[model samples]
Target: MTESKDVNAGSTASKERVAQFNQRFDFGSYAETRQFLDELAELSKRDDYYPDVSFGKTYANISIDGEGQAALREMNSTFIADMQALVTKTKN
Candidate 1:
């Protein structure tokens, strides 16, 4: 699949969009996951980026692309990278 760039998120907003998302969003062990949330918030603020944040008691999701399913078609790589980093860290 062709990767999208310069779509909605620049090169910076990916984490902001992702970080703000996972903050209030639930993920099971809320206490242990504090570091992850802090990392996301720091990355987002540092990069000066913010995405559509959806918060719920049980779950939440973030969108770095434009909006809806179509925007996701053109996902910025930075978002994926950041997410991967988080995943890798958790996995280890």
Candidate 2:
């Protein structure tokens, strides 16, 4: 995949045409990042929804597809909020 040189996430092949929400988080260590990813996986399993996830030792990038539907957009928002909570939990 091509790296996004634009901070706004604009790139030649960056799924710009897709209606999706994206976020990236930085963690203190590999263990913390792994825990966050694990929690996200569990949440996805319980909700029966999965988002595109990419991660490294201390960071994670999440992309939730909404497909331009209101219901799906709302769900994505909630999922993001829930994931944020998990981040907080992992921090502590």
Candidate achieving the largest TM-score: 2
TM per model? Answer: 0.44, 0.69
Evaluate model 2: give its lDDT.
0.75
Prediction RMSDs, each to the true structure? 10.7, 5.7
Report how far residue 74 has shifted in candidate 2, in Å.
7.1
Candidate 2, TM-score vs. the true structure? 0.69
Candidate 2, superposed: residue stretches over 4 Å from native? 1-19, 68-77
lDDT of 2 by residue, 3-91 (tens): 34766655433454665677899999999999999999888877667777889999999876544234446555466678899998999
Candidate closest to the true structure, highest lDDT = 2
Model 1 Cα lDDT, one tens digit per residue, 1-92: 12446674576465335332232334555443554556666656655565555544434455554332233334432653574477447535
